[model samples]
Every structure is written in C-alpha cells, then in structure tokens.
Target: MDVFDRMQNGYLYRPEDPNLGISNTEQLKKQRLFNQTADHTILKRMFAAFGDGSQLRPPLFSVWGGQFVEVGRDVKIGPGLTLVDDAPIIIGDRVQIGASVTISVAGHPVDPTLRRRRLAFNLAVHLDDDCVIGDQVIILPGVTIGKGAIIEAGSIVTKDIPAHVVAAGNPCRVIQQVQVEKVEPKMAKSEFEKMRDGSLYLPEDPAILAEQQIHMKLQYQYNNLEPGDPKQAAMLKKMFADCGEECYIEPPLHANWGGFHTHLGDRVYANFNLTLVDDADIYIGDDTMIGPNVNISTAGHPIWPAYRLKKYQHNQQVHIGKNCWLGANVTVLPGVTIGDNTVVGAGSVVTKDLPANVVAVGNPCRVLREINDHDRQYYYKDRRVDLDE
Candidate 1:
C-alpha cells in the first residue's frame, strides 16, 4: 500500500517516501501567508474543510499545511497552535482551543529497529462538538474528545475523554463532570482597554493589530536578524517596556507584544527560546534564572464556544518574584504569581500560585517541599555548602 493509505489505516510507513507531503506548491504559499498575516481568506483556501464563522489566531503550525485537517463550523483556536496532521484531524462544530495547544496525529514505534528505519504511523485525532481544550494542552494520536468535554490547563491528554467531563493532568484523566454554560460575552471595551483590564478582547481587531504589528516587526528582527548584532541592548530596550540592567535573554524569544507588556528586574537571565505571550503585564523580579524553552503566557480565552467562535480573548498579569529559578520546559499560565526564592522543576506546568522558598513541580505545579536548612547544608548530593572553598 502507498504511504498515505498505510498512514490512514494505522500501519507503519516510511516518512521519507517521495509521494507523502503536499506536492501542491500553492498550498505551501497559502500556509506561509496565513501564518504571516492571520488572513482568513488564506486559511480558508489552505485547509481541507474550513466551515463558516471559524476563527484561528495565527502562527498556526501544521505538518502538511492543513491538507489533512477538516475543521467544522464556528471553531476557534488561539495562537501558537501546532497540528501534526500526518493523518486526518477532524474537528467537530464549536471546538474551543486555547493557546499553544498541540494536536498531533503521528506516533513512532518504541522498537529501535522500527525507529532506525525512520518508521512512523498515523492515527487521526477527533475533537467532537462543544469541547473546551485549555492552554498548553497536548492531545496525542488516535485520541477522541467526546462532545462537551472540558480539558483544563496544562493537561497532556493520552487517551479518549468522555463527553461533559472536566479532564486535566500529566496523562489526562476525567476530574469532574462540568457542563460549560453558553453565556454570551459582554460587549467588551476597545481592544486595548479590554486586553489590559482582563476582559474578553479580540486579538484580530484592526486597531489592536495595527499597534501590535509594530512590535512584531521588532520581535522578528530580534529573533531572526540579530544573531550576532552587538546592539542587542538597544533592540531589547525597544522591545520591552522596562528592561532592567544586567538582564539578558538568549535569542529566538517569542512575544505577542514583543515584550512591550513585560517588565524585568535586574540581573534576570533567560536561556534560549523563551516565549512570552504577553498580552498583559508580566513582571519578573531581580535575579531570576529562566531555563530553556520556557513559556510564560498572560493571554487566555472564554470557555464558551460561542465566545471563542467570535474570537474573544482576555489577558491577565503574571508576577515572578525575585531570586526564583524556573527550570527547562516550564509553562507558566495566565494570572500566576511565583513567590520570591522559589524554584520550579523541569517539565512542570505552573497553573497556580506558588509560595516563597519552596520547590514546586508537576503538570499542575504544586509545592514539593520548603527550602529549609537541608538546602543550606547540602547544595547537591550531600556536597557541603562551602562558600569560601
């Protein structure tokens, strides 16, 4: 069988097969434009089945340029969305997706021999109607979300979620039964005012976008053009509203307002690929060390599909206290506050506030332990803490 047929039927196949990816150059062009501009017309022409009143915030990442994704009517998705659509990704009507969510339809075998041959398989992801997928959620291959299911923040869904249930966690499970009421969102203020006040705003509003575009251009230049540019300081000043002295961020930084909504205290250091979805204020205190691939977001959306279909958005401030260390791949959600001298472990998702002088870690991050005298005595593996030595 051909690679496509094999993938559709859930059989192993080689990804390097010449006939696999989209041969249609026109679709590729549209995909590029859609990401660059968030243009609905380009998105409509790119996907397999895009229905009426559907809205997607762009920078949409897809494997095959949305060729295998069939999106139903009134579906709304937020920014930093990734669709690994090697097989079909079928979305039913009124699906609400949050920011930085990934729906991957492809998986690899565990066997080394199978992997060595560049072998992979595909199983389609199906999202039934009226489902709410929260921020930074990852849905794996062959999973089906039942109608009206609600997956909360920072969930990694590995299996099917039944209808009308609220599910969340590392390997996501049903937490409770919740039927999200379809309440009509109020007529929000001007987009900028609504954004700052944590009310539902549209990211695609013309005036809002016009102002955001200026910062986005600077952000693009900072990420792409300024690899070795010595005037990184100047660029950073232009990017952020309040960038403190001795603060350094490694390149490939992604920000919604180009860090204009963010304020940093002194001696703050961030590693590569720190993404700031700074729709609102993000205050980082002094001496905070952020590890690689950290995502700090201040943007969110309403759970109601009707609100989402209209592409309503909201923002909340994030506050990080002084001397805090966030480990690699930590996702800090909207409206979170991390206390001073706290440490978040690797791969943790901070969905709530963390108190000072503690180590918090998990999918929905919780305090592991307080930073007690044990920490003062031993730094690493019973090694004595000798400052003089």
Candidate 2:
C-alpha cells in the first residue's frame, strides 16, 4: 500500500515521507490562521466537517487541518485542544471537551528496529455523542469511546470504553456508571472545579489568571536571589505543595506553575537549568541530586493530528526515589518512576520506569548493568575512590 493508504489502514509507514511533510506543513498553516482569528464563521470554513453550533475555543493546535476530523452539533471545546488526525477523528453532538485534551490516531512502533526507521501508524478514534472529556485527557489511537461517557481528568485512554460510564486514572478504566440527569442549563463552571476535577476550564478566568500571576512573581523573585539567601528555603516551602528540609534547587529553575504542584522530600539538590513542566503533581524523594539541564515533563499530547490542532494536552505525575543521581541533560517524560540509588547517565531520555541500584543510559533509557562492588573500589576504571580521608 502507498504511505497514505498504509496510514489509513493502520499499517506502519514512514512519517518523514516528503509528501506527508508537505501536507503537514499546509495543514499547520491553516491551523495557525484558525487559532489566530476570533470569527467562528471563518473557522467553520476551514475544517473538513464542522457541524452546526459547534465551536472550538482559540489557541487550538491540530494536524492535517482537520481534513480527517468531524465534529457534531452544539459541541463546546475548551482551550488548548490538540487533534493528531493522521487517520480519522469523529466527535459527536453536545460534547464537552475540557482544556488541553488530546485525541490522536497515530502512534510509533515499540520495536526498536522499526522505530529507528521513523515508522509510525494511524488508527481511528471515535467519541460518541454527549460525552465529557475532562482536562488533560489523552485518547490514544483506535479507541472508540461510547456515548454519554465521562473520561476524567489526567487519564490515558488506551482501549475502547463502553457508553454511559465514568472512567478515570492512568490507563483509564471505568470508575462508575453514570446516569443522565436532566436539568436547566447552569452557569459557567468555575476554574477551580475545572482544575480540581480535571475538566477543561478557562485559564483566562480572572481568578485563575490572578493566582498564576502571583506565582510568576514569586518565581521571578526566587530566580533573582543569590545562592546564599537565607529566605530561599522558606520561599520554596511556600511555593510548592510540600517541600522538606535541606532542599536546594540551583538558580534559574523553571516551572510552568511555579512548582505549585510539585513535592520535594528532604535533602534534594538540583543543579542549574532544571526545568519542571509541572502541570500536575511531581514527587521527588529525599537526597535525589538532579544534574544540570535536567528536564522533567508532565505534559503529553495525543497521537491524532486533529487533536493536536485543537491544542489538547495531558499531564501525568513523575516519581523519583531517594538518593538517585540524574546526570546532566537528562529528560524524563510523563508518568515515569525511577527507583532509589539509581544512576542515570548523561543525556539519557527516560521513557519508562527504572528499578533501584542500576546504571541506565541512552535514548528510551535502558539498564546497562547493576551497581556492583567495582563501583565501590573504583571511581572511574582504576581511579580508586579514596574514602580514607
């Protein structure tokens, strides 16, 4: 099959194909204009299929210009939606999609050989009518969500869900069966509810924006202070959800929410340029030393191009155990866990979980070896560690 046919058929194909690149660029350009303009009339003319009374908020990110995306009537979408529509995305009537929600129909092969060839695949995603997709939810390829389903915030949907159920958690599962209760149209949902419940809510809400502004000022103050500031520790404790004693994060630390969602245990030390994309909770255990330029990200987007164009995103927590050392330029993706006493080599991209007391390295980081007796005697291959000071 040709590349485009393969994509539609869910067969692996090279995404770097020149034809695909050209198509992607054109789609992105259209999406850019769609996001910039406020006129609903103009947006309706751009999509492949847009139903009556369906409106998507601004700052939407998508792929393929919604050519393979279809939206039903009277659907209200929150900000920062992302549609990765390599295949097809079908959203039904009266749907409410929370801010930063991602729905994708594309995925990379797990096989290293195939992945190395830049191979990818696409599958269709269908969200039935009257569905509520909470904020920061990721709907993967080939998943068909049933009608009247509620996908809670921060969940990752990998499989099909039955109709009329509330699903939640990482690798989302059915939480409870929901019953439709008819009532009068209520007032706009509060930002706190959106953030707390994981539904798409407006960040532009004055209360929410005000809080963020205050946090930014605090971050600026922290970044500008000298290394010897006595009040630094107190500042950190106040800014974060929970921060333990003797923790030192080097200056120029960057966090999207000013580390408000992060929790650091005792005696943690992070070097310069430690960037935390802390849209959700991040827990770091005691004595974990983070090296320079380390990035820990909690946000992820769907594989579907249509979802990306809508700017939808999800956030997952990251856990790092005690006494671990993350080497320079290490990048940690969402929902990864690293066990205690582990050493990650420089420039490693941690994609999965790692157990304690091992040395891991490389892209999609894998365990090279267990920490053995040799490490005790030699610092670096015959360079003896002189502990007798």
* lDDT tens readout by residue for model 1, 1-389: 77779977789998888876555456678888997787898877888999899988776778788988999998887766788888899998988887668999899999999999999999999999888887678999999999888888679999999988889999999988774574222111334666888988678855467568989999888887656677787788878989988888999898899999999999999999999999999999999999999999998989999999989988999999999999999999999999999999999999999999999999999999999988988999779998974
- Model 2 spans with C-alpha error above 4 angstroms: 1-208
TM-score of each: 0.53, 0.52
In terms of lDDT, the poorest run of 10 residues in model 2 is 182-191
CA lDDT, every model vs. true structure:
0.87, 0.83
Residue 219 CA displacement from its true place in model 1, Å: 9.0
Scored by TM-score, the top model is 1
Error of 2 at 291 (Å): 0.6
Indicate the residue-level lDDT of 81 in model 2: 77
lDDT of 1 at 129: 88
Which residue ranges in model 1 land beyond 4 Å of their true spot?
22-25, 179-195, 199-389
